[model samples]
Target chain A: MSKEMTGAEMVIQALKDQGVDHLFGYPGGAVLPIYDALFQQNHIEHILVRHEQAALHSAEGYARSSGKVGVVLVTSGPGATNAVTGLADALMDSIPLVCISGQVATHLIGNDAFQECDTVGITRPCTKHNYLVRDINDLARILHEAFYVAQNGRPGPVVVDIPKDVQFAKGTYVGRENIEHKTYKPKLVGDNDKIQQAVEMISAAKRPIFYTGGGVINSGPAASRALRELARLTGVPVTSTLMGLGAFPAANSQWLGMLGMHGTYEANMTMHDCDVMVCIGARFDDRITGRLDAFSPGSKKIHIDIDPSSINKNVKVDLPIIGDCTKVLEALITTWKSQDRHIDRDALDAWWAQIGRWRARNSLAYRQVADVIKPQQAIERLYAATKDRDVYISTEVGQHQMWAAQFFRFEEPNRWMTSGGLGTMGYGLPAAIGAQIAHPDALCIDIAGEASIQMNIQEMATAIQFNLPVKVFILNNRYMGMVRQWQELLHGGRYSHSYSEALPDFVKLSEAYGGVGIRCEKPGDLDAAIQEMINVKRPVIFDCIVDQQENCFPMIPSGRAHNEMILGDMAIDLDAAISDEGKMLV
Target chain B: MSLAQEKTERHTLSVLVDNEPGVLARVIGLFSGRGYNIDSLTVSEVSQEGHLSRITIVTTGTPMVIEQIRNQLDRLVPVHRVRDLTVEAISLERELAMVKVRGTGEARSEALRLGEAFRARVIDATTESFVFEITGKSDKIDQFALLMQPLGLVEVSRTGTVAISRGPEAM
Candidate 1:
């Protein structure tokens, strides 16, 4: 059945039909009609954000935590342009989002009229798909399709550009059930032959490792369960990328920590020495692969991913299976159970012994001083204080983000959110606010750096306005720690513009936003400060002053192989660290 | 195998995609953005009712790079199928070119002589100039244009290469 309604009303109805309960956006002239219609409806709550970029990042956080497609609405021109970075971030990290931007009237699109821009054209490369609603009759259909496209296989952001006239025009509303997509169907199940082959490889190999990534989390909780079952059935050790940290339980004896730059010594060593590498749901990104020529040179790799393009993009594989992670893992488990063959126990023991020796190095070790707070120690204390609570963690891109990933142990999926691919600096604060809105009772915290947190400091107002108790834990080192570390090691310690010269007092700033603030300068005061920040019933900014000269360790310097990482205790000669080959890579 | 050991080769890929606005731009943008080389490209609508368009692209890359291109093209939402005509099957390739020569005396006759030898049709003619239309493989077109250079070749406009497999079944 179809009913005649204005386009703005249809937009609301379509979102309702799609089960969207919250939308993050800011109002402007081009989107006034949609805003007016939004005001008339109470089913969907509008989250007014200070900046469009914050709006996008907040939706990303909401989507990452809740396993739902996040929604955003904004006006034309600058509004659409401001959302580009977030869209690119979502695209790289495979977050599902649907961003709706209002454009000028259809007749005024190309005439340089007020607030007119080519939204679809600008977002084409960043979005999974995009559409311009030239006719009001197509608005409802496009809105539903945008949601469908955003949440489907290898999900990414989608954009729907609606002109002002189309939002006000009267048109027939089309229900989602009436629409049939002809060209968009993703495969869900793996081929039986490939599953059998994978089982044979796993059962015969003496040394094997399961390398996982964010796709397992994106595949939902069932996939993570399947992963655990498969690991138990095969008695194989597992490791993950930075984005895949929570997919496997960190407390499991068979689990190796994250494997890449700044990863654990055991994880990277096993990745290099494994005979058969079972890569499930992870792309071999440049950061993960290190030097492509030397990456897992002896491994006969088997890759399972929903996106076929991810397989063999950077590292070649012996077998490739295209299917959803859960469905494919279920098939692999069934196949492995049916096979009667067993792995060589003696060789597996030898492999584990070698891995134990690497773990003995304690690659994440950092000396704790009596007066100053170490960043790693701060993260450890924060984790210990919140380990038993229902918590979600997000982080900005820098040394502090790496420390959070290393120290925060997650037993389940969807509890940790960070910018893994694009490495955006200001992603954590808004993302935390978004996650807080999704899970109102859960403790949502943004582990931030002094330099990174300032990138989106305006989001403090959004948190206070919504009465969100999200906490921003800043490891204040008074420098862009990652950049400074690289400068010291690779650029003769030039340190050009790497220091935070004129930083604001975050505690005062938080107080100014009608929120609580806590500052801890000594190691002895850290735990109480974190507790105070957590107990506050509103947004709080906890500034923990840390060692300024510290650097993230166990790092595979640029163009270096996995086995050639520099541990925390190892003394580094700057000249030797910056090799000619390292200079060739970014 | 390491990247340095692989030999670089040219491959022709045929892509079937939705015949919609910005589809061509998406294809072209992907090439430029990824730093992939596009030697030649041709696109035309193949099915009006189905709203399908076929694009033929000639690119040069290592074996791994070529595979990457095919996988990347297949990942596009609007794309239906991607076939590397050079390796998938026995294929035929062709292109069309229109060459104009501006010469009055012996050079004009010489241009006409060479055009006839290449089986080129004189589509437009004047007392001082002649426009010849020719169709053949890309290499053959290149050879013809090279021969026309000494014959006062004023201008040449050539369609990029288009290719199809030699089989009873459709791709």
Candidate 2:
């Protein structure tokens, strides 16, 4: 059962045991031995990345899309360091990933040796767990333990730092069989008492809204359907965060849509003005709740999440029901049916009527001055163009990102992946590539902002190499939309350096990189550009030049109440309408 | 944004250690925050000062980095001294861990008595598990931890690792 081999051999065996088919990484000086062993391995296909960060992100894309453990390997120093941010991204998102780093020889370790850094020490905070392999024989088990740790419980990344000597050194490599990890089993089954209490609360509440987050997306399609059914049966409107975009269908009448700063004015107002806010698997992040004291001022919150620590970590909760989101939701449905709580049809109908009025009166607007391309209009067209397709949508953070979420009208769960918690800029393109690889048959596209798209533009090589047919929708505004909007609102129109006149020709850039590129300047041409992108059957980048001055409106600025919104060009117009929607305004 | 990465300063930090498992975790957990980055970290098991083992870690950073690292290392309950060797350049640091394995007969006995001569212990002695303990430099430990593979080296528990500055004065 044992043969003399290098630590690299043991690691490869460990990866195979963990059922890893594809991995992302690059070779370096401290990891030559690993590369040599890796060269001998035939089972795993390694993706060559332009940078180590891309390697980490590609793995993240894979994990987020497939609900599997993503793997990344890199050499010591900068290679290991570059992967940290991506590791942090995965950690924050609770995506399962295993990162392996090569180190200098054990003797040359701290002698100020070139490319020598303590990989385990550096990555500890960013990872669920890390290991520094001082012994070669421990490699197999360490790798095994790493995979187990990364995938178990509320999944996160794990790093295994293997030194050069260890990778080259001789050892008996035993392929891991029946791995035992007694310390880390998460509770999959829901507790009945809390479920019963939650059921009772839901049944009793007259005006209830579901605040859903990434947990809804991560829990899979079952959880989304469960949340929807609960909302339908209870006559409660469901509002989602950016991470929870596709958790509930936007087309569903029961769905109240996005809630927060860039969220629909009505959804935010409803969550603010509701009686009971049932938060399922969503944290009361700063984006959702502008100020906790002023947030949902009249609502009694019931927070249900798998992670116990996340229960009361943000806003105050009346009931902290801790367990799996889907499990607890199903349990609540069971308890709700048994209770047979009386329906308040008048109150439910009245809430919907008020919401409908708010949506039409104070919807996000960009002026249609004949030639101007409103971001929202572009997004609506984009959504309309891609409707009914089982495709994955990834977006860069900014005004277009918000608009995409608002307009996409997504039906399936886990189909929408964006930088929700971290709000990372260069997330979309790579994430689209990962999603495409995870589901080759399904369409994948990146709705990117101009500045954010440039951040990870190097990943275009990956798309080209694999001939991944991911369409890139670049919402070009020639400025950082989010920062520009903030400057305009808070800093009294001090635009500063937000506008960059010398913008790169995205069409030329895409062409140079061997992909189809189209420039759609007007709404009339948007369809043609989109059709051209779809026809490529390879990578395509559509540089859609949106109106530069157009901003995401109905915004509740920082340190302001949700009701105190600047709806469109007329400030406080949204507030006046929302407050006067019905007679029962608190 | 500290975009211009200042050149890493070489620092030698010495730690007086009880040499226990999970001690390393506490030492390492301090520097893994958002702003802090560690460079050139080393640990060893040098016990010239009686029962206490002194660990030396050579790291590089600006003055601010050194101070933070030292302060964090000092906070560890098991650590007695966390002197920055960058400031006090001359202090000795060495490590010792021996690898013991089980073979059929001659190889097995050779490993045993070598353990005896090195003051190593047969920590585990099942028909399969023949654990031996020896102390030396990290490289020596690593080399031995590796060399015993053909002779059945199953698992490893290293007191990873301790460091000290080179020489005459105390850190």
Interface RMSD of each: 1.3, 11.6
lDDT of each: 0.91, 0.76
Kindly list the per-residue Cα lDDT of model 1 for residues A1-586, writing each as its tens digit.
5899998899899999999999999999889999999999899999989999999999999999999999999999999999998999999999999999999999998998887888888999998889989999989888988898898889899999999999999999989998866677788899999999999898889889999999999999999999999998878999998888789999999998988988888999999999999999899998888888999999999999999888878888999999999999999988777775567888888888888998898889999999999999999999999999999999999999889988889898999999999999999999999999999999999999989998899999999889899999999999999999888888888999999999898889999998888899999998888888888889999989999999998799888889998898887685586578886776
- Which regions of candidate 1 are displaced past 4 Å? none
Predicted candidate 1 versus true structure: per-residue lDDT over B1-171, tens digit per residue: 578788999999999999988899989988998989999999999999999999999999998889989988987878999999999988999999999988988888888999999999999999998999999999988999999898888899999999999979787
lDDT of 2 by residue, A422-514 (tens): 677888888888788788888899999888888889889888988788888988989998778766655566888877567789989888999
Cα lDDT, model 2, residue A163: 87
Off by over 4 Å in 2: A1-4, A172-177, A341-343, A571-586, B1-171
Q: Which docking class does model 2 fall in?
A: incorrect
Chain B TM-score for candidate 1: 0.97
Error of model 2, residue A561, in angstroms = 2.1
